[model samples]
Target: MDVTTRIGVVMNGVTGRMGYRQHLLRSVLAIREQGGVPLSDGRRVLLEPVLVGRGATKLRELARRHDVEHWSTDLDTVLGDPRWQVYFDAQLTSVRHKAVVAAIEAGKHLYTEKPVAETARQVVELARLADAAGLRHGVVHDKLFLPGLLKLKRLVDAGFFGRVLSVRGEFGYWVFEGDGQSAQRPSWNYRKQDGGGVVVDMFCHWNYVLENLFGRVRAVTAKAVTHIPRRWDERGEPYEATADDAAYGIFELDGGIIAQVNSSWAVRVHRDELVEFQVDGTEGSAVAGLWGCRVQHRSMTPKPVWNPDVPTTERFRDQWAEVPDNAVFDNGFKAQWEQFIRSVAGDGEHPYDFYAGARGIRLAEAGLRSSAEGRRVELEEIAP
Candidate 1:
């Protein structure tokens, strides 16, 4: 690698679990240690993250533990610094738009977690602002970078899917209430006032996943509910779950493919993976998760004669083939971070920009609207 060009990034909300583990520990720090992301031109962009968060102890502990030299509690001061060219946010969804807007006004390149804003308007507005300033901006769409999804994309690209039929995605795991065991997630995730809802959170993810893999989500018919009314908080106190813990949705995609996804924090996992998508096409079908993918071709499909009279024994589970990892796979979030930094360095084109993030927010909004109105809402066509 040529002399590495360090890109200083102000990382906020990294004290949180997802932010800390995925963005900081797995992505940024890993990139730094590995001598940065390689560009097509041979040069590399080394990420220098300045850990910023609300809690001083956590920040300090994280900094010391991770050997991060620069850390700050003041976001404004960090953003004002000329040394840092990128401002990254993993903060609460409620405050994300305001922070991103401030970062944009500061004339810095931007990167942040999903659902860039609470509303579609704000998401689009951020994309507009970033475009107007001619600054590089990206939001997390890590699912696309997952190894399983990558393999699935390869199948689609290879014409293995032929004409795609329908997609079914199941994403959920039980989150223990604070009563008997500590809740795995923060209490804010269960409170709507804190911008907590399954539709807003997971639909943003499903948006790009479906769009990129299957097709664009044209319309959505959804039902959302707060499955658990009350849950114990970190303080061992019971609080009303104002947010929807569960959401069941069916999306009408382009090319007449139907997509259905169920997201819930209250459900138990019974599938092979915690989150899985089964894509059934004309010629073949594939089930993909974060790490693994299984495929079954129409030619290899089991044909069992339907007989209600007697129980037939056929090994249906053994019919499909598992997609092997011929190559080492990087962390999903880390992979996206590398691509984003490469794009920032003018090495590659990353189309998953702020506009894509807005589309994600649009899908989320559409799901909420459909659930509320009990009608399928059409997605306003946006540029891919």
Candidate 2:
């Protein structure tokens, strides 16, 4: 007795790069192709997305391209409709709060991209609203679902790395200056007024990674800087890069774990992956990238003597063993989407909700504050 239930969703901000590629194309469409999300009781939840955005032309194009039955430029009308049960947002950080608030008022279960709002206060307010309305709400925690990180978590869970010590993370690559070549990232990413900055964007991610894998973040000391003074926009117009393009942060996690992460858009890549983390512990150590992970256990630890006079002979990089994927890995965004859909259908509670999103925002705020004041900022528990 398998039953397929169609869940209508109002999807806003599909015109943006992340919204279009990851959410619309990869996650939602891929789920539909897979015959929806399966429940334990032989039931399936099929998503029906109604594309909503500011640009009618873009929405119409996307709807037609995806063969979506419904598309709308009028968010109010779409929100007022009782047919749509869920609302998903991948909008800009600056404008996300209002739309999320409206969706909650309309009684739609919420699923959204991180930094749910510009500030911690706003995210807490949204969490309260969703709770009051008795709706399922979730913020994306995609990085945890990454294959490399998943393997890292598996090792941690298996006690492979007994008594974790510290973590070092490196993320980012050079963005072409608009003057010589077109910038890879959006121009707004370098503008502070539009909620742009490496600290605001990356600290949110670092906070969750540290909190989930190691321990909750206790304090943060960060240095944020604008390395490149000016860059060209999409239209080839020159503008001052007012926002910080780079951030070097030291986070103190619970249980005496120290995590250092460097996020930048100005640095050149010298590693296999754009983002990588090296976790050191008492028993073992591991280096994990976006898709690959290598580990060196205590039993196989290599000891080399430092000799500056002669050429180094030890192949340090080749010493670690690669971590294999024990199971098939789904697209991170798609997996999270399925989980959120299940929660909306009363399968179970979504773990990364608005409250979690607020904590990320708080971390970003703390990092920025620390940079501005030249001091360490301690994290305060946010009331759920």
lDDT of 1 by residue, 9-62 (tens): 899999888999999999999999999888877777888889988889999999
Give candidate 1's error at residue 143 in angstroms. Answer: 1.3
Query: Which digits, one per residue and each the tens of the lDDT, describe model 2 over residues 24-122?
Result: 999999999999999867899999999999898889889889999999999999999999999999899999999999999999999999889999999
lDDT agreement with native, every candidate: 0.89, 0.93
RMSD of each: 1.4, 0.9
Off by over 4 Å in 2: none
Evaluate model 1: give its TM-score: 0.97
lDDT score at residue 57, model 2, on the 0-100 scale: 88
